[model samples]
Target chain A: MKPNNPLKKEKIWRVAAVLFWLAAWQGGAMLLNDSLLLVPPARVLQRFFALVREKSFYSAVLFSLARNAGGFALGLAAGVLLAALAARARPVEYLLRPLMVAVKSIPVASFIILALVWLSGRRVSVFIVFLMVAPIVYGNLLAGIKSESVQLREMGEMYRVPWPDRVLYIELPQLKPHLMSALSLSLGLSWKSGVAAEIIGVPRGSMGYALYQAKLYLDTPSLYAWTLTVVLLSVLFERFVLWTVKRAYARLERL
Target chain B: MTRLIDICKAFDGKPVLEHVTLSLAPGVTCLMGVSGRGKTTLLRILTGLETPDSGTVEDRPGRIAVQFQEDRLVESLTVGRNLQLALGRAYDAGKAESCLASLGLPGCLQLTVSTLSGGMKRRVSLARALLYPAPLLVLDEPFQGLDADTRGAAIAAVRRGAEGRAALVVTHEAKDCELLGGRLITL
Candidate 1:
């Protein structure tokens, strides 16, 4: 018999739990006996496979992916720049306080609708994603900068470490965990709010439009399949981004 | 020569240093004081980390290497990178390796600082200060967590590295001053 490994055992338990949930979902669908109300997991998987075979599926996925990724990048850059400015100058922090608060407090749906008035339907999702992601990244990065070691800063100053070297060596290492957290949280919000904006705006060549169509025709399995696609895409993008960040840090550490 | 003329510093309405004057030149100086006697406050004033409320610092060099009371190293980075933060354009892989060896930490350039023991971290912090190319070196409690044997080695390394440059080391031990052949300044 193979040696009993704790990690392997944990994996087995996770698989079992997922299987149990699928079984419960299947049983509930059978009892309901209405595909329109609640589609079976198997049927959703089948529809998902069928959608994957369609050429339009790739276009929609690509369209949504591009907008979400672009918005996330813009938000990340703006947040970091704003946080740096805020950390440096008290006046900037004071100036940005109300703006960040407003962005955070506003509801995503309201922002999506407001964005629709200002932007084209295709561009609304991008704007909404940026709005959702910026404040989160800004807040976390500001906190990280605030919490950075005064002692380390003094050390840098005493050694006369250049600005670029100080950032690459001292600041970046200290900010990694905060940046990772900001990325993790904002990525999910970006995808969710992006898709919501898409559904509301009814943008063409987008996953949100496909979801809207599925809902219009009362095609429950198609809705479930599209939702699953969104979830998978969000998860995959997050993992990819986080993995790249970790690899970069690893290489930096090796130096 | 660098001079602090009649320096006075207070924190939260309590005086840490009061009208204290001192001068530093190209030699080792051990600053000894009892707890709460402002030995570190003096170092901070000299290194320009803290400004004295009523005094002037004359001829202070723009670059002074410092080993802080705490390790203050980037925990996720390797020993080499931590040193590189201080050494900057002056960093040399071979010199860094040899410096670590002299500080009794041989072949530890690739080891992450978080994995090191407290004493090892202290030595790395000291090594960074000693390796930095600066006119002055300020070490605050540089020998805090080491055993007697390691402490002796660290002191010897400091002695060797402080040649042709000014060093102000803070400690409570008179023997440390004797070992470094440094003039003792008691606060």
Candidate 2:
């Protein structure tokens, strides 16, 4: 096992680097004497605290969270199901090949704009997030499934174990790591694409709406604050979800 | 009875088993072959997972069990669960617990297959095959990872398990023939 030093004094070098960068930002803001291009870190922090107290700000956070999370969950389900099907049947994979390629190649902004004409603004983020995630989940999961050792499957067959038993015992253990890889990559992508969709669609009273309002009104501090809030939420949610997956893996390794 | 007649197996373009004929009844039989000489292929053919180019097998009992050259066990499941999967619902926990006890693997039912040493996994696979209520058992190098003492016990367990059933074992060890009372067939 490796040494455990969560935040040793050695990290002080990194801290110094961070502090130096922040000082540089403050100096640049002072020289610019303008809030439009960039606001000082202190003012941004102030606006962050101010927004933290507002109930509507919490609602905005919740709104984006709900849509993005919902989309991610749906994508995960569909991707696994589709990958399983595709793995077992060549016809299914052939049918899906074109669609998966298109989904992978297309840009997020294109999809967001195209979806706006068809879907309600409130649902655009969900659709965009789902689109962004499904192919990654599908491709990685299918690859994972394919990489499964055939020796294990043949042993299961010789034992005459039931289908469910084979899936639970032989297939699942090999599949878990691949599924985790898919989830880690797709979760971050969904957040980026989901929020971008929201900013463009500008559904009423969302985080995107707040950011846009701050920009239009020249409230640089509020805009910077909201950006920070989005960044924080994205990081926090990723950590929480990944931590759960890692715990599951640790438990499985002991099984 | 397990019968293979006119068995012909080929890979790519070359033939492995050509016009081969064999039969095995209710006894321990050892298959001896050179490395890469297609012992695994023949075993796979017996399991119906491989197709011989021109062969017909008869009396292949359903619910047959195999302990392949490789462990072929889920490396993330407990030893007990591995045996349970092979043995089906007929597995008695007490019986399984006792078997593991005798095999020096007691109190390890909760341990995952991945955490086990190579010898431990070999024993687990051996135990799984022995516990399964199959009319026929196929084992390929089942003693590969066992120490001398463990090998003796595993040989005894296999003999007891194959008392009224047909078994096919593949091993290069000469003592394996004497241990299991196996009739030798060299290819």
Candidate 3:
């Protein structure tokens, strides 16, 4: 038999904590005696498993995942590129400052409604998710670039290190923490805003549309199931992305 | 040879270095001074990292390598990685290992820079600068955290690496100048 590791212990605690919450939910549902208002955890799980057996559920999950992933990748790329440009040029920074501020200050619902008017329901979520993620990534990366190691940069200059090598070796390593933070925060945010946009837009074949249907039919178990799916998918996706980035960083450091 | 003539620098209306003239040739030259006397500023100017108020640098090399007053090693990287970043395509693994061995840091190439002691970090920084392919080398307080025996060995390694190259060293210790057999220039 293999010995226990801290990771296994951590997983056990996480599962226990989740089970504890589920038990409390079940107890509350039992006391209230109203499945309409609050469904038990077992009912939610049963509905979720049944959902997995349906074709529409699979289609909705795929649709929502694709849109969210696409918007996130686009925003990440644009934010990183803009941040690099802004860090190097003062005029670019000045040009972007007010736009980023306005994006940050405006409400997400406002953006969704405005985008819905200008774009189709299919594109509205993509646009909303992009708007939600870009500013955060840009801000965090700009801070990281601005606060990059001047000592290391100077060392690179002294050694005549090429600009590409300096960025790869010195700047990126320093920016890893900030990039990871931006990714984690923005990933959750993109999912929230993207799903919210879908719910409001009620696009066909989307998880959000399924949620709206559940609400309209007063299916509390399905509501809880769909919400649980969203949360679980979001968490799992975040873990996978962070793990990939960490591995990439480790490999780059070796180079 | 790299020559500095009538170099002056000030920070926030306070003079750090004033009318300093010095010349470096293919040998070790030590700049000795107390703290805050602009020894570091002079080295920075020589390396073209800082601009002097009004002066001309004669016969400056096209490329220069420097170890700043701070060790300035990237804490996130390993020792070999740091050296490789500096040396780039010119890095020779065998030479690098021998150089580290000479400074009493054998088998430390893969250890991350953050895990190293202050003395070890200092030597690593020096080794990185020394490994870079440049005709001119500038080091500021390169022996700050080293013990007496390690300092002697480090000085010997530096002297060996600096052969036939114009090297400028900054320090406050008189014995360091003697150990390096360097020509003294008091600032």
Candidate 4:
């Protein structure tokens, strides 16, 4: 007989809990007898399966995925560069303080509306995601760089250790935890605000457009299915990005 | 050999080291004093980490090695990597292995610094300074976490490393001076 595994047993219970919830939802929908108010889980799943088979579904997924990924990459690059600059120079920090604070404090919706006037609908999500994520990365990484030990830095300087080696051996490891935390928080915000922008802009071939169309026709099952798709994609993307980051950190340690 | 003439340093209007003049010449020089007496401040001024209010450091070496009060090892790096970082282009894996072995940390090259005991970390810090090729060595509380036997061994290792070179050490224990076979200057 196969050995009993606690982790496998735990996963079994999680699946059972999800099934119980689905059954409860189906029961509630039956009691109401109104598909418009609350669609049954079975119907939502069926619609989701159907939606996945369509070519437009793929198009919508790819369109929004591309914009969001583009924005995330751009924001990560710019944030890391700016944070490095600001950490080293007091004048740079003072110059960027007001702009970073403004970016952080401004509402996502206001930015979306303002961006709509200057950019095309397709680029709106990209701009909003960039705006949402850059400040988080900048603030967290700046704090990480500042948290480096002055004593260690002095030790490096006295030893005449090269600047690149100091950064690789001293600063990067110190920044790892802060960078991981910032990425975790910003990745979710990237998707949430990106989707929100897409919905407002009504980009022609995007997931947000599908969500809007489902609501316009009062197709509750399709709406639920589209929402589920967005959630799944977001989770997959997050897991992929985090796994990549973990691998990179492992490599750094090995080096 | 390095020399400091009338080095004076202060923090927030309170003097830490006042008009202190000393020289390190081809042997170990141990600085001993009570807490807050500026023994460390003097070492810092010699290492160029801090500027004296009114003093000049003479014969400053082109290259210097130092072990701070804290271990200052990158916690994520292995023992060998820490030494390599300090030594830079002069790093040699075989030399590092032998150095660690001499410090009672054999085969520790593969282990991350965080996994080491406090005494082990202190030894690693000392080993890094010893292995680096420099004319001058500044060691601050190098035996802080070691037992009597380990402290003796570290002192011997330091003496071996400091042969034909100048070393400045700061410690609370007067016994360290005798163990290191060096002169002690009480602040």
Can you write out model 1's per-residue Cα lDDT over A150-188, one digit (the tens) per residue?
A: 988887887778998788888988999999999999998
How well does candidate 2 score on lDDT at residue B160? 85
Q: Model 2: number of clashes?
A: 1
Tell me what fraction of the real C-alpha contacts between chains A and B each candidate also makes. Answer: 0.91, 0.81, 0.84, 0.81
lDDT of 4: 0.91
The alpha-carbon lDDT assigned to residue B53 of candidate 1 equals 93
Q: Per-residue CA lDDT of candidate 3, range A108-159, in tens?
A: 9999999989988887788888888899999999999999988889888877
What stretches of model 4 exceed 4 Å from their correct place? Answer: A1-24
Interface RMSD of each: 1.2, 2.2, 1.2, 0.9
Pitting candidate 2 against candidate 4, the one with the higher TM-score is 4
Segments of candidate 1 deviating more than 4 angstroms: A1-4
Whichever of 2 and 4 has more lDDT, that candidate is: 4
Top model number, DockQ? 1
Predicted candidate 4 versus true structure: per-residue lDDT over A89-113, tens digit per residue: 9899899999999998889999999
TM-score, candidate 4, chain B alone: 0.97
Return the clash pairs for model 4, or none: none
DockQ comparison, 3 vs 4, better candidate? 4
Over the stretch B8-119, how does candidate 1's per-residue lDDT look in tens digits? 9999999999998888888899999999999888888898888889998999988888888889898888898888778878999899888889879999998999999999
Comparing to the true complex, what docking class would candidate 3 get? Answer: medium
TM-scores, each model vs. reference: 0.96, 0.93, 0.95, 0.94
What's the candidate order when arranged by decreasing DockQ?
Answer: 1, 4, 3, 2
- Candidate 1 chain B minimal-lDDT segment of 10 residues: B80-89
Q: How many residue pairs clash in each candidate?
A: 0, 1, 0, 0
Q: What is the Cα-based lDDT of residue B12 in candidate 4?
A: 100
